[model samples]
Target: MADIAQTRAAPLRHSTAGALAGLSLAMLVSSLGTSIANVALPTLSAAFAASFPAVQWVVLAYLLAITALIVSVGRLGDVVGRRLLLIAGLTLFSAASFAAALAPSLAMLIAARAVQGLGAAVMMALTIALVGETVPKQRTGSAMGLLGTMSAIGTALGPSLGGVLIAALGWRSIFLINAALGAVALLAAWRFLPGDKGSGIDRAEAKGAARFDMLGTLLLAATLAAYALAMTMGRGHFGGLNMALLGGAIVGAALFVVAEAKVASPLVKLALLLRDPVLAPSLAMNALVSTVMMATLVVGPFFLSRALGLGDAATGAVMSIGPVVSAFCGIIAGRVVDRLGAAAMIMAGLVLMVAGCVALAVLPGVFGVVGYVAAIILLTPGYQLFQAANNTAVMADVDSSERGVVSGMLSLSRNLGLVTGTAVMGAVFAFAVGTKDVATAAPVAVAGGMVFTFAAATGLVALAVAIAVAGRRGRIA
Candidate 1:
């Protein structure tokens, strides 16, 4: 195996700082795009004279495109050059954003969003891989932390920024803003990013001209698309179509596994995933923790609005605290992880998350807003720490040559967690409250449902804690 540690060049012409800045900007743009369009759904429905289901596709289409294409694009980056792919993705993303802004019809806008998703997928798949290639081994944790910070900030700001832009300049302004940001990112990437001449594995792969695993790639994409569709459509009802999609996803996944094992150069190295002691556990922990965290995000707003009788503005204000805390904590987590190692940080983070869930479950009605704020503070930093540290741990063991696919797997875990969290938690809330939507349920029902939800989330966190504990004997890196 080619050792990534031995293969990395000293540093790029612009150094680690410049590369980080460019990558961070790219990550921010991609993260922002994920949730920014959500605020415009109602407005889009009115403008296009479309029904709710049609307008909802504006969000669903983007998400599905990203989920389906991310892994394949990541593998492509490893074959070509990461820097080259980043530049191309940034340019394509910026152009797509421009097209979206200028869209004359809803269909055009949706198409533009799909293209944007593809571009975003490329960028997302490469961010960690590029960082691994650029940053020194000793400081990888810090770089991952900074990247996580930017992602948190972008995700936190997306909805608020979208609302503000839509209010000031209309929904098109959101894409216009993304275009401007994407342009800046593109310029920075072009100026700061080094060529892949330094990456021996990329060069070797190019020379060998290995056949791309089209069969495995297609199976993986189909599996993810079917799974995402099942989860998205299965929210309200587990009807025949949802069941069919779910079955298709299972079949596709099983086929993908078999195809990957036989392919000369598989889209995903199933053997690596199973054999790597650190990487597999870290990925599993990330997925589980993300599931718990996203469940909170999905239900917290409802708890604030219905149970506590808070308005949109107040709820938004309260909700902003978590991301704000997370951003700052991410910055701090890097240095701490560098000193204490990822396992320590992960263990601490899991403890905090479990505590926060317990607080939310038990103290919300009793302590009121204070308890909610406390829970947010705990969960925010907890998640930030876990994300930055766990990423560092995952990358530590991966060969530089394999970073692309590994990074894609990490990203896939998070996306899967989000989809699963929303579907499962929503179902749990519905079952608890005897309603399809918790938002419309009575205050008492909402409160009871939230408690039940948080209690369930706490159990998930406890499982994560057990994983962290079992893996704690070894050093993270």
Candidate 2:
């Protein structure tokens, strides 16, 4: 494991609070980009006279674009300059948002969304990486926690906000809102962010002519696109096409590895990922925890509506609790991590997640919605703690030149986990219910599936705990 650096670049001379605000808004808008359009999909389908599957691409295009381009853009930031590139990203995002709002055709909207996602990928990657330059080392956890809070707020707010906008003004209002917010974020960034002292890359590294690996970047993007499509296509029903794409992902991954190994400056350093105890385990735990979190999103609603017999409004309200709790708890979690240290807080967070999962597995069946809410109360804070601590642990020690790429990797791992959870955890729940059509499954079966899915989530988090412990031990060794 690499030793955690006590410091990175010198702290910014500008107002730290303002810089944090800019970063927080950047995180918020990017996260909002992810969830805001989801609730508007049906509205879009009707408005565009498109099939549900075609409208679904409105969401998929954004996600696929981000997943494909995030790391490449991160690497681009390291080479070109994070601050300059981020400004460009913000401009692109704002323009793309307005474009989406005014798009005359469904095809154009999807294309605009794809471009918006490219901008989001840059924002999401550089925000965390830039933290080192914005804040003092001692407050890293707190800054991370604040960013997490903003992200949770965005995710929690998006669906409800989009619903309201669509009802009052129409679907296009959502994109218009994003355009407005993107403009504000861009202004904040331009006015408050620190100047790039060394342009992200070390002067020595730049002098060495560290070039971007375009082939490696393309191979990785293609591989990730294949995997994302495989996991997402067919609406959770893995078919022949999904299987073929999955195979393509595997082969592409192999080729990517080969290309990366031989590249003069790889997008990702294979040796660093393989040998860095902290980075490797951190990425794994992030994916695992994200998968568990997604289970709550994918499976919780089913359990609430079918098993508990909640109405649509009631289900949505109850389902919003986790993100709301996380939004509030994020700062507190960061404080705790700052006090307890990232490594220790990690174990503590995982323990709480395990407990939360176990409680969910049995409490809902025994105590109903109250039990579910209680379990979430326990789980959400744990997630905030883990997210803040895990991010801090990974970013605190990374080579300064590679911060952008590392941040991108962290985001990518979480996204991959969500994609996996949507497919794998959903399948697990459906299998447990013993039904192809979960919407009409018996209440008892839905409850049973809830138990099974949360139980699996427990095991996954427990494994993450083990990984955290091992990483700590490796650090000590």
Candidate 3:
């Protein structure tokens, strides 16, 4: 890992409460924008007369682009400058959002959304990285905790708010709202963020002009792109084609790994990933958590709306209840992590996640006041624990020089995991539908979901217990 440095640090000053508040708001704006759009997909589909399959692409495209690019751009921020990218990202996001609002066709909306995703990538990559640069290290966890809370709130509020917005205005109003929020975030970044000469930026431009391995990046990009396209095309109609594409993507990913292994300053530095014990565990955690989180996403809507017979508003409210609690609980979890260490915090989280999933998996048709809902609330705290604790461990383990790559790898793991989790849940649902006890199909699907998530959580718990029992002082985390 190459260290990028600024010759001088900005003058030390504790940012005002107002500035911190502004930063949290920026996070909320971005979180709300994405969450709101996802929840409103049904309305958009009806408005555009889109096939269910095609409408999926609209949501998937944004997720794919954001997942693929966030890590790369985040590393670029460390190489160049966080502030420059922060402002540029907001500007591009706002412009794209405005354009999306006016898109007259589905094709246009998809393209515009991909661009919006690119901007979001930049923002996600830099947001926490920028906070590290701006705030003193001591208060960093608290700041990040609040950001997580906002994200949870946005996610919880998304469906209900999106439904209201679409009912009152139109589907386009979601993008319109994104435009306004982006503007505010832009202003906050410009006015409150500290200034410094972007590290490694001018250096890259000088002398012989060193190049980051664009080829390696492009190869990996194609791997993800092809895979996402295959996923979008999945089903009996294109099952054969999906298989072919999946095969090609697997080969591309293999080649990418080979190329990264050969290069000194590889696009991702796969060597670091292999050599560091800390990094290895972190990556595993990332992949597992993503798989669990997205599996719930796949199953939650069906359980709430179809099985529970809840309307969109009620579905949103009930489904989001866990997230609402998780949001505030993240702060407390972070503090617990500080006191007890990552190992303890992580173990507790994984255990809760399993317990939560078990409840839902075995849930009866009727809610016993807190039976179904309590499971969701239980699931929420664990999510907070996973995000707040593992992230801290990752940061603490890796050197600042390699932070960009670390962030990128984590981001990639998360996105790919979402796709994989969704696939697993889809498979489980399809299988359950074929059973004789078909009326209880949803619960069976829920049980299958718990099986996958618990497996993931179980793996993490095993690792956490090992660390706790052995007292392994790892280098990478």
Which candidate tops TM-score?
Answer: 2
Per-structure clash totals for the candidates: 0, 0, 2
Candidates in descending TM-score order:
2, 1, 3
lDDT of 2 by residue, 1-477 (tens): 233342333433477898899999999999999899999998999999999999999999999999998989988887877877898999999999999999999999999999999999999999999999888988999999999999999999999999999999999999999999999999888888987767545642764536778998899999999999999999979999999999999999999999988877788899979899899999999999999999999999899999999999999999999999999999999988888899889988899999999999989999999999999999989989999999999999887778888999999999999999999999999999999899999999999999999999999999999899888899899
Error of 1 at 285 (Å): 1.0
Clashes of 1: 0
Error of 1 at 307 (Å): 1.3
lDDT of 1 at 447: 91
The global Cα lDDT (0 to 1) of model 2 is: 0.92
Q: What pairs collide in candidate 2?
A: none
TM-score, structure 1 vs. true: 0.93
Give the higher-TM-score candidate: 1 or 3.
1
Q: Candidate 1, residues 1-477: lDDT per residue as tens digits? A: 357765563333665677789999999999899889988999999989998888887788888988888888888887777788888999999999999999999999999999999899988889988987778888888988898898888988899899999999999999999999999999888777767764545464654536667898889899999988998884467789988999999999999998887867888888877767778778888888888878877888888999999999999888888888888888788878888998788888888888888888988889888889988887878888888888888888776567777888888888888888888887887888778866689999999998899999999889888877766654344
For candidate 1, the lDDT comes to: 0.85
**Structural similarity to truth (TM-score) of each candidate:** 0.93, 0.96, 0.85
User: Residue by residue across 238-297, what tens digits does model 3's lDDT show?
Assistant: 478888988989999899999888765677767666766666676676666666676566
Whose lDDT is greatest here?
A: 2
**Which regions of candidate 2 are displaced past 4 Å?**
1-13, 199-209
Looking at candidate 1, what is the lDDT of residue 302? 88
